[model samples]
Target: MNVSNLLKYCALSMAIGIAIVPNANAITPDDQLVIGMSMDNLLSLDPAAASGLDVVGVNSNLYDMLIELAPKDPSQISPAVAQSWTISDDGTRITFKLRDDVTFHSGNKLTAQDVAWSLQRVLKLNLALASTWKTYGFTADNVDQVVQAIDDYTLEITLPEITDPKLVLYTLGSSPSAFIVDRKEALKHEVDGDLAHTWLTTNVAGSGPFQLQNWRAKDRVLMNRFDDYWREPSEMKRIVMRHMTESQSLRLMLQRGDIDVAMGMSIPDIEALKQDSHIRTEANTRGTLYYVAVSMKDPKFANKKVREAVRYLIDYQGINESIMPNYGVLHQRPVKSGLPATLPGPGYALNVEKAKTLLAEAGYPEGFQTSIRVLSQLPFINIATNVQSTLAQAGINAEIITGTGNQVYGAMRERNFEMLVGRGGGGIEPHPHSSLRSLVYNPDNSDEAKLTNFQGWRTAFYSPDINSIIDTALLEKDAKKQIKMYQDVQNLYDTQIGAIFPISQMVDTVLIRSDVKHYEGHQAATTRLREVTKER
Candidate 1:
């Protein structure tokens, strides 16, 4: 597709409007306790349709799922609406024992039927939220069937095959895979034939600790504590998320005590803020992989040797030091550390001579020129510029094309660019099988299917042999066996996959007001607002 066509599609996709104000004066009353955030951009407010971190952070407070990750430690799955769960001997079936006391914000009692309906809705919305499934190789199709309530508190789910350990982890944790919504209320505002799935784009009804009170689109989103929430009530009565896109303005707000919390501040600015006595800094290794996706559809990147050479040209250590200093760590596997079995092994090593020779063999002895698309966010832009410098040393002339996060994604979907620098957030799953499948697996003629060919960069297409291995990995019940199977898939990605240039895991530095208490971080780039309470 051409640039004009791509732009037209982007305009259509984002009809919601960009009402963000970067330098607005402090508007919230001092008694209300407002939090300021420097956001990348919110793509959608609908929980099922949300794909970005900013959108997820906001929606997480609005929606509750059947199962939730423990706030203090993400490795364990804790009860939310469900009191407990059970698995079949073959691991093909999962039975959830629900909590009878929980109720949606609308006051309807939570039921087993609601859980079944919610899973079905998630499957239908998977197409629109393909990126959410990339890390776990999960799709709506994995759910072979759903069995309704044996009683008001019990629900059962059966898979077509034995599910892998990572797939199980994803099923229990990923927001897109497990978040539960109210079926009865969602169906009242149905878009197409599916009410639960359709109504989610603009509306929500959940049993979480907080409930969505109002949304002013790009301007602000307000959520209030759920008085009858299933869990203990939050200390804060209301959470007001104001959209700010400028780092300088956010820094000023943090300094002036206008916001209790600030997100996405620049690295240098965060360091400077740490010196202040009133502010406290918290950082965590968010399981995210930042990399470049080169369009393999382009003839220049069609060769395996050429792609491998590009990987060698990148200085992972230098990029981490210069661009991410305190907020990033070089990643050896696509899977981030702190998760299970993500130990370092041989992948790409920096070798300038190898890159030079490979370029020469590809008929670009003096190097060829290409443009890489990047988001306006500081970390992404810095990485892209650093890549340009690295590639230049290997005789390749590369230019950076900067745009909004949505704009850059739009260009990537249309295959209108040669390369794009971006980050792919990992799910709680400890394997790369899901991540690889999402990026490479083709499902009908969907955009995900089209993009799955890695923009046509794979030296050799995904074969039946690889496909069968992935299918087997998904079914393996043993934890050790599952990890072994995933390692096999990672071997294939490290040797032959197209589009991705694996780099590093994300470490986000968050600044919070010293008075804020009970802050708990998530593996994804989020924190539980329900746990936070300000000192009087």
Candidate 2:
């Protein structure tokens, strides 16, 4: 299949649908972890082309980047393939000392040349992952010039004159684009100018703890431990990511011992699992967030007061405590809480009177009706329903339209929707400027721009002031002032009413059997299976 068809095939399969029950005859070894959940976001296995927090989690196990984030402390950087790195005082150049023992799954000894090649390929391909690296000032024509290998053990990266050096490392360590692949293995399979995309769509070409053993689209992704991995080998020799979408099937599989771990279960199912003696459920607050977007193209929402009123229409406490229990927290800022440069906004309170008054001031005293598109999956559909009800209480009618992610989110991306309740957050690097870019930065709304990275663009919202704040903060040298710039951006967002982040969510409730051990979620919502072992 071609590239576009391949993406459509994957998207069609991952689109929210009926849950397929796992075959009962399947058996797992004592050292194997058969995880059950809907693998929806994993489109391409190629490190250069793939994107998403789930994709990051899977690719992290397959490819070893020069650096990695300290699991517990996202603010701190840790070495992965590169033992150490140094930045130039000017904050424009960085040099990494690559590890000598690292070897690709293809049995090729990793060289600094390979590291340079992998990064350059991201620029050459210009896929979704490319945004991670492209955010730094390197372009396809100049990436080769910007990225160079000092020697077989040393790789160097040169940045723009005004770029923040820390942002480079944070982007390299956390973004999917940084996952280094085997230089030669990928080219060996290159076809039709695809840069090995056709082959890599389902193959593994990295040096992580686990290697891709098999991938049956819409069914399961089977990965096996890489014995020659540079780090300690995973205790579980294999992991099976079962393609089960329904929360009930996941809960059922966990109860019957069909799957060792069940992730992404609904709130009610998660609560019921707590009562089950055989199941152990863990809920960790992650960097993921849920927010509402008002299309600026819509005349009603174009009014700032109407947008602010919509924010107050949401019952943050009632929604989280009752409908989306443990899914998210009451956070309304553009950035995740506790991150540097993150400043709290005058959070929208649930008050029908307040909403009605704002509506009246916006010249909609009797209120109006609008359509909201959402994914027909757990939590989102439920959350949309709750939002609909709340808006109705304020005399505003919100009709809910449910569809697959491709239909709902794809529409949002194409700028074809008036309003949407979307899930997004990029706080994995602990930077407010970076996270806000995903939520509110829209330098251009032109079709030719196609700047999907900026969610604000999707909602037809654009502001030169906020966009300048994002650009300035990213390149700001002084840490304190950079944070102040971010604070200014948040304050601008509060008054302008571009988007409303009702809450930041934890994202998952993982159910594991008592035998399961050491399973924890990364801030990006990807579960690392290497440290996971069973009591047996």
Candidate 3:
């Protein structure tokens, strides 16, 4: 577990397709930040296509967004490339004045044109991240008109719909699709008029603090500091992010001082790390929620009484206490905690006898059989097993189906599942509408509508009243009234017994060496490494 021994393991891990560094004197160098994490989902460097937190962390460093969520307070916004901005009284347009000193890593001066093009490309390409923009009534065909560069330093965005402009601002600040790319440099590598989409998948073009040296999929990512960065230069000359998925191995590496930071570790390993004098563990609660969802497409779940019975069947307190130690905290409300509009937990507890009685009342004296789809991971698989045991108590024969995120959530997205234990609902923006829109806003319910992005639609759980309330709450300019409207929505959902029942709000934990300074994790997952340093 020594530094030299850990380096040898690193060399072996990189033997396949990664370049081996020679004469590596130190594992945790003062001027280099070494991170250990699972890069399985770090599939693309392309901002338009990247989907997970892994990519968000990488892109946040390699690219610049107009604005960023304040590191200390995610609810507040801070300036990045756009130093100043103004919103119209009508709440339809926003004008941004780009900072004059920024320049892309490629030496081209960063301008508002690049910003406009970057946002437009996301919609035109219509990739994974484009859905966020599409929700704001932006379309591929009209993106150029919607997002226009007024001049070299000025950009204007006109919303097609009457929505809260704060949501759009939050999207610009946090969404991966909002990262500004060097338009000229990207177009230089274009293939078949793709706007360098294919090239960007593996490479980067931005004016951020770090420049990607090389990225070996599922291996490691190497980034060198950009000395010409507009802001204070990054203290670390280089960042080496090694793809280590095993929690014990990461624990060993950290214990030996081989890695400066370790993320996505198991709860047991995380607990063990808490006892280490040289390592510190930090948990930042995110906006996303973990919930048990039932597809109303299933006749059994379509019944409100059955839905209520299923709610009573869940041991929310038990699961949150035993299984969700480092993963999440108890949160029953649909909207995430810490928001003005958010309501208190409804305190739904396990009532097996009541669930059984309700099952009988729902015309099922004998509990029916169903399958629970869940991701084959620590907390998810564990939650599903617990749910299975509880469901059996009420004579419900529940089979646990485990698979990868794609296999499990894809079934939910296609509305092809009976029941599912999943984690989602966009909470990154710190806006109440962000979570509500993703979790419960089902604008359309027809099978042909195919609004797969919304979990409400995916579960075939459509409530016109809930949808109308959400819409009104978003547009409610009066702050106090908006808060009241959101609370009312939660109350209505409680009485209606919605298909998706939230169990906990997610909390992401990371273990860093005690000497690592200024390395705060962002709740939005866009943790910038520019200010990070290590004390030798």
Candidate 4:
């Protein structure tokens, strides 16, 4: 069945609910983490080409980057493949000294050359997520000259003086594009000199803790523990992730102990399971933000006053406390709180009378009717449906359009939709400038501009002043000065209504057996399996 039909079928069955089975497979193997999750598809296994949570959730098990965030704490950065590094006094050059003792799963010793090759591959192949690195001036055409393996154990890269050194490091620390792929092994599998791009999609070539055992698309994935892992191997000897999206199905699987962990559980299911003593639920306040974007291209939303009115039409508190309890927090800032460049969110709440007055001033005295496209998934469907009812109170009737994320986001990217209730931001980087640049601050809004770095381009929202402020904030090396610039941008965000932010940053929750340990959630939903252990 398609997403719509599948969800309907799942909902109907959910009403009947599954009974507690006798053999709830309660005793998971002491050496496995069988995770249950939701995904439309796992497009590619090549880390460079991967974008969604499906791939990111477990890629780290097979790859190691030069630097990475602490699995338990995103606020701090930790060395991975690189033991130590130093930056030039001018902050334009960085040199990393690698760990010679590490070896890839292929039995090939890790080398600095592999690092250079991987970085260049991302730019040359122009992978799906290359834009994240483009912001720091590293491109395929100029990479050889910019990134060099100074020796067998040292790697070096230089940035344009105008680029922020921190931004470059941040991108590298974020994903596998900056990781070391076994060049010798990768080249052997290369077809048509594709840098093994075609081969690696279904293979593993790294020094991380796990190896890709098998992958049957639309069905399941199996990763086996690497005995020769450079670091201490995880207690999990195998990880089995079945392709399951229905929240009810996932909850049932967890309750039956058919799976050790259940991700993407709906709020109602989570609350209901709270009474089940055998299961554990954790809600982590992540950096992800959920919001509604009003297309500036639409004449109805072109007025700033009308956009501002849209913010007050919905009950932020009611939704967080009732509809989204533990799922999301009431955050009104464009950049979520605690990240660099954020300010405490202030007074934007449900004021239906005020919203009606603003609508009248904008010449929509009788209010207006609009439509929003959303994914056929939890939180979004519920959030949009609730917002629709709230908006009607202000005389603005919003019709909810339910579909896959591809359909909804695709429409936003083409500027083909008037509004969208979607969830996305620079939640992974934990930086204010990253969120602001990705969500707002569009200076060049033309077809020729091709600014995928700015989502505002998708919404047709342009603000040159805020754009300049964002650029300024990014370049400031002084932490204090940079944060102040972000605050200034947030102030503009609230006044200009550039985008409507409903929740500060939402969290990801998972239901697991109580014996599972160290299964913390990350903002990107990129859960690392290496550190996870199970109690006897």
Note the Cα lDDT for every prediction shown: 0.65, 0.77, 0.87, 0.76
**C-alpha RMSD values across all candidates:** 7.0, 6.1, 3.3, 4.7
Q: Which stretches of candidate 1 lie over 4 Å from their true place?
A: 1-33, 130-144, 194-199, 343-351, 413-416, 431-468, 473-485
Q: Which digits, one per residue and each the tens of the lDDT, describe model 1 over residues 315-375?
A: 7878877788556788756555664545565656678998999888878888888988898
Tens-digit lDDT track of model 3 for 383-493: 999999999999899999987556787788779999999888785787888888888888888877666677888898889999899888888889999999999999998
Residues 1-536 of candidate 4 have per-residue lDDT tens digits of 35664454344234223233345456456787777776653657786776666677768777888988754567577888999999899888999999988898889999999999888888778755666666676677898999999998999999844666766777677754665689899999999868899998888788888888888765667788998887898888988777677777777767766578887788788888889887999877766678877788899888988988888887787777776775677887778677646676686688999999999999999998899888777677778887888889988888888876557876776778887888767766767867776788676788565555457777788888888898887888799988898899888867778854655467677788887888876655556788888885
Clashing pairs in 4: 331-504
Model 3, which residues run further than 4 Å from truth? 1-26, 188-195, 447-450
> Between which residue pairs do clashes occur in model 1?
136-434, 137-434, 164-474, 296-456, 296-457
Model 3 lDDT at residue 357: 94
Alpha carbon lDDT at 516, candidate 1: 71
lDDT of 2 by residue, 1-536 (tens): 35653443344224322223333322345777877766665667788767655567677777888987776677788888899999988778999999999998889999999999988988888765565565676778999998999999999999844667887888887777777878899899998877788888889888888888888765777778999988889998887777777887677657756678877788888888899887887766666588777777789888988988888888887777776775776777878777767775465678889989999999999999899998776777788888899899888998899875557877876778877887876757677767777788877778666666567777778889988888888877788988899899888887788754546555566788877878877675434678988875
The per-residue C-alpha lDDT of model 3 at residue 28 equals 64
Ranked by lDDT, the better of candidates 1 and 3 is: 3
Against the hidden true structure, what lDDT does model 3 obtain?
0.87
The alpha-carbon deviation from the true structure for residue 432 of candidate 3, after best TM-score superposition, in angstroms, is 1.5
Off by over 4 Å in 4: 1-21, 182-204, 339-341, 366-369, 477-479
Rank the models by TM-score, top first: 3, 2, 4, 1
